[model samples]
Target chain A: MSIFFSLFAGLGLFFIGIRLVSNNLRQVIGRRLRQLIARAVTGAGSLALFGLLAGAVMQSVNAVIHVLVSLVTAGAMDRKRAFPIIRWANIGTSLLVLVAAIDLHALALCLVGLTGIAYYQQIDQSTRWRHAVGALLGLGLLFLGTDFIKSGAALLRTEPWLRLHISELGLWLLPSFAIGAAVAWVAQSSTTVVVITMSLAAGGLISWNGGTMLVMGAGLGSAVSAWNLAGRLQGSARQLVLFQVLLRLQGLLLTFIFYACNRWLLDDPFNRLLDHFQLGLPARFAAFYMVVQLLSDLGSRTLEKPSLRWLEAWAAPSLQENLSKPHFVHDEALDEAETALLLADKEQQRLLACLPAYLDALRQDAPAALASADKRQAAESQVLQLCEQFLVELADRQRSRDVLERSMVLRDRNRLLGSLQESLAELHQSTRAVMSDPTVAQLLDHLVQSLHIVLETLAETAALAQPDAEELELLRSLTHDRSDLMDSIRRRLQGSDLEPGLRQAVFSATTVFERCVWLARRYVLLLDGPAASPDHPK
Target chain B: MSFEHDINDEQGTRLVSLKGRIDSATASAFEQATQDLFATPNARALLDFSAVDYISSAGLRVVLMAAKRAKQAQGRLLLCGMRQHVREVFEISGFLQIIDSVADRSEGLRQLNA
Candidate 1:
């Protein structure tokens, strides 16, 4: 009963210690972590070292994984570049077990006291220093938790029934492996399981071979937990999680092969080597962890191509899968202002790309073209509405004045596009209505030709990021030309004899055409106007 | 479309009845017939548009041009008997403020002569 109590308390403290340390450390490092990741991609070695350093400070591999996943999702870092960070982070996470193996309770306690004193003196006014104090306290709690786990294992060693149960089942290795995996999965931290394994090994409660098999299972358990944590993610983010699982599986395979070799040989080569270094059970346990990590890293580099091919086969479709779906507004990206803004820009471009096709559909005189135009309008309308909702959510999340202004500008542009679409539909309806009158039909045919030119120019100018001098001049000329032609048609209509309703339909068609030109001009100004200004160059 | 005009002789007042749409198709005809009326020096011309169902920007443009010509000829151009839709067009184009509109031809004649 005492053994169960100690073990439960130890596990509880372990969970709290890890959470406190990682959360506070993350708070201290906040934006700097993102900046470090940005700079870390300069070289493969730097990226690996960055992962190691970050994991060591963050003290939780899951936190490092989240940051890497976010960077990949935001398109800041390629998935290929992100693999090294994940690989090294697993290695960095093993470092805590090594540190905990040593008796650092006294030193950690002293550091905790000093930080507490500093905190009480109000020396930690800045959030960073306060986080530093919290981190030191977490370190103290971790050391204390290690002590409790060691004491708990020692208590369990005295229980004859528990000893018999473990000793009777363990030599097979598979049962121990399964038990270790179950514990690590529940704890969500293989490092904690490893620390517990070390305690049992040091207490002479478990054999070195048994400890190694358990560690292998812990590795697999960490991978499973990582998969669970990233379950909601898709595309490259989920791909990274799969790669992480593959990395752990490789480590398990290496450890299993090494265990098999050691079991086959009468000499017991690995244990003999441990004895040669004058290492104890604790040191050997940590060495096993370090060895598996090194072997996995090597395996990753050698099997990079096949591993990537395999992962790609299992990868989800990218955000650009369907034009009607929301592409740029990823939920994961909303956490970062820059990434969200960039995604919004991409969505705007996607919607703009649909404009030319819609106009072409409108101008087509065939029955099939009209049907296609309706379909295109429906898709474009759905996409535009989704994009508007996305932009509004993005703006609500972001506090920057620049982001707000950009979102507003984008909203305005989208609104204008929507109005233009409505006008085109109205024009289509009125144009057909007046077509039944012979005199008006003749005029409508001439107007359609002129209107097509204006629509073509609008579609062309809208697609450009910035209209050149000639294109701008051409747009102005075309807009002026359409206006003049509409005026002349209006004057001609005044002289022709027609029914009142038919005349009204033609007049409305002309009005709709004028509005279309106005919208086209507004679209040009939105894309190139302020950005091209001297104070805000493109 | 269809347009009907009735010119009534009164002291310093003339009421012309217009029916149907005064749009691009009929604006010129409406202007051509009303041109001589406004050309009468210091004569007040009241255009009753109660029967007119619609008016377009082109019709508004012509009306504005007639107003300017009327003012230049030292005559007044008055509008009356406009339907709701026609009044909305004038209101939307901001022509309502520029052109004088009344409840009926009598009110238009009263304002023009006054």
Candidate 2:
């Protein structure tokens, strides 16, 4: 019972340690990490490598990928890039096995002391160093961890009905593996299992055959633990992890076959080379086990892509669209209204891109382009249709309190986009009406030129993930000019001696321009999101 | 803009019609519309969207600021005939959630005011 309690304590500590490290790191650098990774990761292969490297660096790619997945689902990244980045993340993920397998068989006390001291101090470096040291200390604990495991095995050996069957190396390996895998899975730490296996073997408490089997079991058991944790999260994530495990399991099966064929292959010629050496049984066992782990880790990630692709094909539709950063964010999900809002926004923006081209075609009277304009029109039709669908769904939802408010915002935004077709028609009519008046016509033409520049900037703004400061300032300036024009038009309307018809007409034209400006600002606000926008462009 | 809504014995039925621009200068019109409904016996009103063409922050304010007014009156306001320009103004400002909207006066008058 005491032993079981100690084992539980050890496992509890392991979970707490990983959680502490991951949480603090996230607090210190969570939001920026996504931006950084997005900026850094480009090519698919490299992105995958980045994912792996990030996981290795953070000691938890699971956490980083969670952030990435959230951003991606929020319509943040190019789909093509997201796919590749996710694929390569596995490359770095495989390295954890290597981290767990390393023999940190010394300096456990110093690690704990340093970590304690670092945590006590409030300096920034100390805190950062504390996490790093805690990880190292955790790595160092693996050393004493092995000692504890050996002690456990020693205690087990003394028990009266202890079951230690002596059989061929491969035969005994399966049972050893079964025990090891179960231990690692339950403990949620392959490191603990590996060290425990090593300690017992080194202490002469378990045979090399048993030790080797535990190592093999550790490989299989890891997926069990990972899949278990994966199931707790969302998206196609659990499915993706399961798919990844299938690939790893295939490697395990292959390794198991090699274990069976070991005697045949490593017989006399292999025996003679080792026979001359005075290597300890424990040392030889550790070396052989390490070799197996490295090969499996490297080979599984690299070679299993094709198989994973096949698995992914089966797995794609199986993934849930939870839109969460599964590993990090637990409950941060957009409600149906929000989901609809974002989807509608994206679809609307996509539709908006067609406006310039269509307007240009109409201006040039390009009949051929009218066919393409029809495509744009169809796109707009799709946007409006989607908006209605989203609105209908939004209407039906019983959202949470704050999100309810956000829902209103989304609904409003959708309706705002809905006004486009008719508003554009009015603008076109107003332009034609005002253009007929000789005095304002040239000014209107010039203003349209300027408006086009402003709109070009707006379009450029539309194209940009983030607009440049100078361009943003220019946009503000254009809006300011538009507002000024509004003021001037009002001033002109107020002048008493003017023709009543022209006065009304001028007033009407100003209103149309003002409306256009207003809508443009609204859509622009949508693009900038709810972030604080600078008042007016330069 | 000043707004008015009136709904009948359909319980949640009412109609609100407007008469001015909706901005800082004329935001009171919008407020008066909701306030006038609140002063009435009806618990529901359809907002006559035909007259209201422009909306600004101040206009949106009256809609949001008087949220408790309709509920206190045991009534609600449903917006109707929200021309695209007006609807876009509401949307960009995020007014869709606070007030119920319909295609026309009849629909607003019939839809649930609550």
Candidate 3:
């Protein structure tokens, strides 16, 4: 087959292989992997190393970051801690390209083929084999893309117009860096960008230096994604994002200088030794990129806190958006304290969106989720503060008694929502504590669900006192139904071979739900128009 | 005990009646009783926790799943025949809000029958 045709075939096969691998492996080892990530440290060095490894494994830096971001938001790690992990992720990702550029197609093909068989092997025992295919598919895509760039470059060896585009290497570096950064930001996968650049280099499409420079530029670009995710969180979550941006910016500055000096120092003997002999241009470039990446990643890892503090000093004043004033939620409005408060509320609403999920999560075992439990409480407190702020403003504006009642109901609901998160967190902890007795441990997931259904029902009905007969009927029946579930759990708690911690979490969740119902009950009283809290009668 | 579940999609109700106890051990069976349809009624479901001599979160999970399933379908989950203890379970634990509970199967029959 022609080179282009071969390249296309390889690329297609490669992607298919990776899809199969990721899925199968995810099935086989998803929990172990998630636990490892959840337990990862806050320091940049370790995080970056993990990133690198994940990037290397997936051969997609952007994909790793995306996964990391999702994990972080899901409370696998504090957003504050994701900074260095991202740094190392980049370094690890670059290695894929370096290996590919060396033309290790045979190794790539073998791994992809064996893993592909395991993936499509079609047996219950080999379920994990299916995910192995996802890994290979990624590798295959890497090779196929590389092959395309190489043949394309071989064609370029004869094409003069593109050659005319080459002599301006330094000028090209500037644009390519910007281009790589933009592409990485948009595609959200640094590996893809680097692979493309590597393909161009192996094909002799871009000069050796051009491809290397772009790889470096890709590093700067990958940082933007972490910034966006961190921006998506509340409080420390927001700070974590800014910290990531600072690390990336410093790395970029250093990279830019390195890129600029690379051309001037091309004639240096050490570089000359790297360029000539069996080492080759791309290999030398790879070595240089590796050293530079190690330094920048390590530097960012060490200096992230201090460096971000510096970046914040300069950038905070220039930020224009404020969450407090109700601008769109995605505004660059990072630093304003007033807006930050409002932003926190938006985050709480977002958390509310996760109520069902939280309910599901709580029904399981949660040994690594203590941090998430803490975060849930913090978010609820912030929401309460926001409601209080809004309430104070409403009272000052002379809002009506009915409006005040509505505000109180809303505030109470918000508090209940927060309590639910803690309850769920505790539920998970309890489930783990009692796992030895699967019967009792398994019961906790159910108990939490029973509690959740009630909270949601109240929210749906709004606990209006004079609720229509249908509403009353519905409420009475579901309440009774849930009571059935609770009784069984209590019995199990009383008699089962469960741990003390497990028993306590279940008891606590059961209690919180009951109290929330108490709030909902009073809410019904409020529909009596100030009759709910007679002491503060209108 | 034999259990039969009928889903009235257009009417928005999942009617499940069981001849056995609805306790932790049997809840999974209760849930499987209606696995054929995830969300009840797209708007409402009728659960007969009556044959349920006992109920637990395992049963509540089935209820919550049904509730979530019903809510997503833009319907409602209406449960009935929770014994006094069952009634207390929903009351003290607060599963009532997320699910609509009634006194007996007749109440659900009346609600859905109408």
Candidate 4:
């Protein structure tokens, strides 16, 4: 009972230590880590290497995945580029397992001792080193937990009941494999499960063959955990999760094949290779774990293109995801300020073109192919955010006065576009709210129709490479201040026998419409260039 | 409400007279009624909206589409005889700035001839 208690406590401590290390390390690295990941698009080899380093430093592939998912969601990194990094990160996690195979009692105590000293001196309170201290403490706890589990497992080796149960379970590989998988699925970490199996095998409580099966089971279990975690995710985010699952299955298959070869035709070639190194049971199991991850990585790479196509087809991108991604702007363009500004300008034009889609639901004759207004609005907001980030990044880089001035103009237009989208969205909502009222139905119809027309016109004007003066003048006339017109409508509604709620709805709709027109006019003026923009001076 | 159109040629101009409500149900027929005018390059037409009592956004879209088609074909489209409510729709939409309009048919013909 005491031995079981020690093992349970050690497992709990191990889980907590891994969580603390991953969370604090992420905080310590902060935005710089994300920036590095975002810019690591040079090649697959470099990205894979970076993933390996990230996995080793973070000590958990799950943490690395969370980071990748956010970067992909923010449009900072491409999902295709992230695939290799995810696969390589799996192999990188083996570093901890390998380190655990060796005795680290002294190092673990030293880490804990230093952390205690830091806490006693209030050094852990310092902002600069706080996360670092937390990470070190987590590492110390991790090592201490492993030592406790190992010692507890060794003690359990002498228990008659435990020895009999293990001996019976080891006879049939299925039970051992099932137990390992169940524990790993519950724990949400395959490495943790495999480490426990390694400790058991080293204590002579489980045979080497049973330990290998358990390790393979752990890999499969973690993949299942990943699938559940990604149940709510869609599009490319879901694709990453599928990739993780496929890689784990591949690893499991490869390990099974090797096990079969050794058991049948090959006459234990794998065990012979390990025997040549004279490694202990724990070290051999660690080697087995590394090999499984390596095989998974290598196999997945071989099938990368086909796998990506399948994943994409299975988890097709949503309209919102498609809209959120910037089609014209590339981070690489930031190096050349002029090119960066030009690309951003093109992206902004695309955004302008998307404005009319917000009224799709209100359009009686709207094309069936158009996405819902809600999806369009959400996508537009995301695209706007990405554009803003790109412009900010461009501004930070070294650039000449001319390029800087152009970037500033684009930034100002970007802000106006954001405001225009918000107003239109509000207008759409307000218009929908008043559509059912008999007194305002006709007016609402007219408002929706007219706004749609103006938005379509603005989109057309934006698409032009160099809009003629007539087009500019037309936009100006269309978007001119309509406060008086809105006011007149309000006065007329106020005098009529209408509910106050309906009247307020009309008022809100018209005000938003007026704001939309004004913002559209300002956006067009900016498009005309700073010199021609009277309302927005350079 | 039901809508109908009558088309005829007067010298070099196509004269189309539209009647009744031009809402969603009738906007498509209205568009189909004037498609031939834009099919011919540089075609000139005068659309008389005097008989049309009401026009919705869909109706406005058809009119806007005609105007764009006319411009693309390097032709001219002139609107006249629009009722007060009908004219307000175009005014609020800013279509008046781009599409040529007159108060009556005779003025539309005179402008087209000019």
* DockQ (CA atoms), all models: 0.02, 0.02, 0.12, 0.45
- The best candidate by lDDT is 4
**For model 4, how does the per-residue alpha-carbon lDDT over A1-538 read when each residue is reduced to its tens digit?**
9987877877677666766675676566543455676666558779878888767655556656766766677665778888888987898778878887446678879999999999999988999989889988987887677666666755756788867787666677898888778766755567777777777776777888788888988888888887875797899888988899888888888888877877887878788889999999988999989988888887787888898899989999877888877898776787876677778888888888888778777655566636666667778877777678778888878566666677788889889888878877777777776686778877776777788778878888877767788678778888888888888988888899898888888889888888888888887787677422333222
lDDT by residue (tens digit), candidate 3, B1-114? 433444454344557765554544566777776565543334445777676555545565576566656655676567888777666555545566556778887788678657
Chain A only: list TM-scores of all candidates. Answer: 0.57, 0.46, 0.43, 0.82
| Model 3 chain A: worst 10 consecutive residues (lDDT sum) | A317-326
Model 3 DockQ class: incorrect
The weakest ten consecutive residues by lDDT in model 4 chain A span A529-538
lDDT for each candidate structure: 0.67, 0.52, 0.54, 0.79
What TM-score, computed on C-alpha atoms, does each candidate reach?
A: 0.50, 0.42, 0.39, 0.81
Clashes of each: 3, 30, 55, 0
lDDT of 2 by residue, A363-424 (tens): 31112443333444433554454355444455456455544554455555556555544454
Deviation of model 1 at A347, angstroms = 9.6
Ranking by DockQ: 4, 3, 1, 2
Fnat of candidate 1 is 0.00
Interface RMSD of each: 11.7, 14.1, 6.7, 2.6
lDDT of 4 at A211: 85
* Model 1: number of backbone collisions: 3
> What is the CA-based DockQ of model 3?
0.12
